[model samples]
Target: MTDIRHRYRKLVYLTWFLTLDLIMFGAFVRLTDSGLGCPDWPGCYGKLTPLGAGAHIEQAYQAMPYGPVSWGKAWIEMIHRYVGAALGMLIIAIVWMAWRHRHALGHSARLALFTLLAVCVQGAFGAWTVTHKLMPLIVTTHLLGGMSVLALMTWLAARENPGPPVLLSTRRWRPWLIGAFLLLTIQIGLGGWVSTNYAALACMDFPQCHGQWIPDMDLHGGFSLFRALGELPSGEMISQAALTAIHWVHRNMAFLVFLILGSVAWKLRADPVLRRPATGVLLLLLAQLVTGLTTIFFQWPLLIAVLHNGGAAGLVLCCVTLLVRLSRKSTVPQGIQYDKHRHPGSRLAPAPISGTD
Candidate 1:
C-alpha cells in the first residue's frame, strides 16, 4: 500500500511537469509563427521530421524558396509536434496509473481518464488548426484546450497531496472566488483569440483605439466568428477592421477582468491561509499589466510577449489552486471534546449536577 501511494505521488508530479512542457511548446509554436509551417496534420510535409522529408521540402522551396515552408519554420513545427506527442504519452501513463489504483487514489482515476480523453480531443483540434491554415477559432480553441489540460493537472496535483485544510467560518466568499476564476479564464480565451489572429496591435492605445476611445468597430466583419479563417462569407479576404475589432474587444475585456480578479485578491487577502496566493495573484496581475503595456510601446518584443502569455496562464492556475484549497472540508475529527463540568452522581462532567439533582 505504501509503495502504491509513493508511485501515485510520482505519477501526479510527472503529469504536472509534462503539462507545463505542453504549454511552453504551444507558446513556442505560436510565437514562431510555425503553426502552419508544415501545412499538414500529424507530420511535417508528410514525414515525421522536417529533415526526414528534406528532399521534398527542398523541391518545394526550390520552386519558391522564399515561401512560408522554409527549413526553419518546418523544424519549429516538427519540434512542437514531437513535444505534443510526448505529452500525449504522459497523459496515457497517468490514465493507466489511475485505473490501476482507483480505490486508493479516490477520484483521481476518473479525473485522469477524463484528462486523457480531453488531450485526445485537443490533439484532433491541433491537427485541424494546421490543416485549416491556422484558422483563428480552431487555433484559439487549441490554446484553450491546452490550458484546460494544465488546469486539470494542477487540480489533480492539489488533490493528491493537499496540505492541512483551511477552516473558514464563512463560505460566501468561496463561490465568488470560483466565479472570478471562471471570468479570468474566459478573458484569457478571448486574449488567445486576439493573439492567434494576429490582432494584438489593432488597438495601439492603452485605453482607446485609433485616437477614439471606441473606434468605429465592425462587429459583423470583425467577429465573423463562423466564417473560415482568412476568408469572409463572400470568399473575400477578412478586413483589417475585423482584426482591429478582435483586438479591441480583448483589450477592453482585460480591464473588466483585472477589476474582478483584483477584487477577488483583496477579499482573499483577508484570510491568513490565503494571503500568500492572493499576493502571488496580485504580483502576477501587475506583471501581466506591465508586459501588456510594454508589448504595445515596444512593438511586441518576443520575450515580453511570451512572458505575458505565460504569466496569464500562471495566474489562472494559482487562483484556481488556491480556491480549491480554500474549498476543501476540514478532515480533523470534530466529535472529540474535553469537558470540565462534572455531574453530582457522575464523574464525566465537573460540578454540573445542581439543576439535574
Candidate 2:
C-alpha cells in the first residue's frame, strides 16, 4: 500500500509539472503567431508530422512567406500539440492509478476523473481554435481551458501532500483566498482576450494609454464576446479603439489583482505554516509586474510575454496551495493551543504542549 501510494503521488507531481510547461508552451505558440502554422487539427496538413507534409508546407510557405504557415511555425504548433497529447496520457495514467488504488489511497477518484474530462474539453477547444481560424472567443476559451487544467493538477498535487496543519482559525481567510483566485481568473481571461485580438501593443504607452490616463476606447466592440476574431458583431474589421479597450481593461485589472492578492500574501506571511506559499505569491506578483511592464516597453518580446503567461500559471499554483492549506481539516497536537494574544499580529502560533501527551 505504501508503495502504491508513493507511486501515485509521484505520477501526480510529474503531471503537475508537465501541465505547467504545456501552459507556457501554449503561450509561446500563440505569441509567435504559430497558432495557425499548420492550418489543420491534430496533424500538419493531413499528415502525422510536418516532415510528412513537406510538399504542402513548402507550397503554403512559398505562397505567403510572412504568413502564419511556415516551416518553423508548423514545427512549433505541432510540437505544442505533441506535448499536449503526452500530458493527456499522463493524466490517463493518473486516473487509472487513482481508481486502481482507491481503497489504499483512501480518497475519492472524482477529481482525477474530472481532470480527465477537462483535458478532453481542452483538446476539443484546441481543434476548434484552428478550424475556426483563431476566433478570439474560441482562442481565449482554449487558453482558459488550459489554465483550468493547470489549476486542477495543482489541486491534485495538494491532495497528495497535505502539508503541515495551519491553525483552524485560518478558515476565516477562505473567502479572501477565494476572491483573489476569482480575480486572477478574470484577469487571465482578459489577458487572453488581449493576446487573441493582437491588442498588446494597442496603447503603446505605459502608466497612460496614448499619453493620457484614459484613451478613446470601444468597450462594446472590444468586449463583444460572440464576434469573430478582429471583427465586430456586424462583421466589420475591428477598430484600433476596440483593441485599445481590450488592452486598457486588462491593464487596469492588473492593479486590482496586485492589490488584492498582495494583501492576502501579506496577511498569510504572518503564519509560519503558510509563509512559504505566501512568499511565493508575493514574489510572483512582483515578477508579474516587471514582466508585464517589460512586455509593453519591449514591444511584446517573446521571452517576456511567455514569462508573463507562466507567471500567471505560477500565481494560480500558489493561490491554490494557499486555498488547500487553509481549507484542510487541521488537527492540533494534544495539549497545544493557539495563542492569539501572545503572538499579537501573527495569524497562527502554537502554545507549547503544556505537558507531553
Candidate 3:
C-alpha cells in the first residue's frame, strides 16, 4: 500500500504538469484558428494520429480550398488531443492506484476519483467546442474547464506530496484570498469569452473602447451564451456593438481583478514566512498585466496571446497553492509536510483540497 501511494503521488505530479502543457497548447490551437483543424473529434480524420489523417485532410482541402482545413492545423489540433489523451490515461492510473490505496490514503482516493470525472467532462466539452463551430460560450467554458481540471490536478498533487502544510498565521487570509481568487477566475472566464469570439480587436485603443469611454454596445446580445461564434441566439449576426461589449467587460474587469490579486499578494508579502512566494506572485501578476496589454497593443500577436493564456493558468495554480497553505495548521510550521494533517481517516488533509492529502 505504501508503495502504491508513492506511485500514486508520482502520477499526480505527472498529470498536473501535463495538464498545464495541454492548457497552453490549447491556447495555441485557439489563437491559430486551428480548433477545427481536423474538422472532427476523438480522432483526427478518423485516425488516432495526424499521419493517418491524410486522406481525410485531402478531402477537407478539396471541399473548402481556402477554408480552415490544412496539414499544419490538423497536426496541431491532433497533438493537443494526443497530449490530452496521455493526461487522461494518467488520470485513469491515478484513479485505479488511489482506489487500491483507499484504505490507507482515504480522501485522496476520492479526489482522484473526482479528477477522473472532471477529465471526462472536459473531453466532452472539447468535442462540443469543435462541433459547435467554436460557439463563444462553449469555447469559453471549454477553456475554463481546462483550467479547472488543472487546478484539481494541482491540488491533488499537493496533497500527495508527502508533507503537512506550512501554515502562516495571517488574519483572515483565507476568505480574503478566496474572494480574490474567485474574482480572478471570473476575469479569466471573461477573457476567454473575448478571445473565443475574436473580440479582442473590438477595442483597438487601450483604456477606451473605440476612443470612447462607453462605446455603443449591445450587452443583451453580446452575452448570449447559446449562440454560435458570432451570432445571436436568434441566428442574427451579432452586432459590432455586442462585440464591443465583450471587449469592454474583459478590459475593465482586468483592472479590478488585478487590484484584488495585487493587493493580496502585496499584503501577503508583509508576512516574513510568505514574503518570497508572495513576491514571486506579485511578479506574475505584473507579467499577466503586461501580456494582456501587449496583446492589445500588438494586435493580438500569437505569442503574446498564448502567453496571456498561460499566465491565467499560472495564476490559478498560485491561488490554489496559497489557499492550501492558508488552510493548514502545523505544530512545527516551515515548509510543506505530509501525513499528520493528511491521515486517511482524518477530516481534513490540508493539501490537494478537501484534505485530500
Residue-pair clashes per candidate, as listed? 6, 0, 6
TM values, all candidates: 0.88, 0.93, 0.88
Off by over 4 Å in 3: 1-5, 162-168, 331-357
**lDDT of model 1 at residue 174?**
81
lDDT of 3 by residue, 1-357 (tens): 778677777778878999999999999999998999987787887888778988888888899877778888888988898888899999999888878778877788888889899999999999998888887888898999999999899888766643333444564577988999999889989999999888888988878778899898999888988888778889888889999999998888988888888899888775544566567668888898899888888898999899989988988888777676666555233343334433664233534323442
Predict model 3's lDDT versus the native: 0.82
TM-score of 2: 0.93
Best lDDT goes to which candidate? 2
Models sorted by lDDT, best on top: 2, 3, 1
Model 2: residues >4 Å from true position, as ranges? 331-357
lDDT of 3 at 164: 35
**Worst ten-residue run, lDDT, model 3?**
345-354
Record all residue pairs in model 3 with backbone atoms less than 3 Å apart, i.e. clashing. Answer: 155-352, 163-337, 163-338, 164-337, 164-338, 349-355
Which lDDT tens digits does candidate 2 get at residues 25-85? 9999999999999998989989999999999999999999999999999999999999999
What is the model-wide C-alpha lDDT for candidate 1?
0.78
Residue 219 of candidate 1: its Cα lDDT? Answer: 74
| Rank order (by TM-score, best first) | 2, 1, 3
Best by TM-score: 2
